[model samples]
Target: MLTYVRWYWPNDDLWNYEELDADRWALRHVELRGSDGVFLAAASLAEVLTARDSGTVGAVAEYERRYGVVPEAPLPPPTDALEPALESVSPGEFERLWRDARRQLEQQTGI
Candidate 1:
């Protein structure tokens, strides 16, 4: 068997949950395991980072250091019922979606 990895991009300062407006995402080999004939996922960090909201990964991670937790993050907003990619989504709709996801996370996590 093999372990897997997941990467995420979070909006806000990645510091304060209060700053967590929660928009952004990306995929990376944040983790991994050795194995064969199973599954594999790989991509350039730049490519993955591009999906991220708008911060350099280092900055975001640094912010998390003092906060004790990364900002709340969910998937990017959908453009419409037919489209769910950020490239397709309107700016306003994306903002709303980010806020909504954060609101939901706050309610559930109580953070």
Candidate 2:
């Protein structure tokens, strides 16, 4: 099982974090959206948290390349009223939700 959490930045940007497990709290997937609620990028939590250049272009860079502007950086782990409680979910359920989100984004953006 895994845990999913969401946070809203002050700028109205959103962050989705998937944890390894409910008890562990180690991050897995991290997704980012713009203030306009556009899907900007998705990457491993390590990638976003560490800001490490893995020598390969990441989703964030690709998004910037396609849109011609860099999206806002992932803010530090939310510790205020911005964060909501973690929701536990099975791995398969998480995958389904992720796929659905991608499909919806594609339909909305036509990309």
Compare the candidates by lDDT and give the number of the best one.
2
Off by over 4 Å in 2: 1-83
lDDT of each: 0.31, 0.49
lDDT of 1 by residue, 1-111 (tens): 211212222431111111112343332221112232111222223443443556665654432331223223443344445422222334454344335444544454466
Best by TM-score: 2
Error of 1 at 99 (Å): 0.4
Taking all chains together, the TM-score of candidate 1 against the true structure is 0.26
Clashes of each: 0, 0
Q: What's the TM-score of each model vs. the native?
A: 0.26, 0.38
Cα displacement (angstroms), candidate 1, residue 1, comes to 41
**Candidate 2 overall lDDT versus native:** 0.49
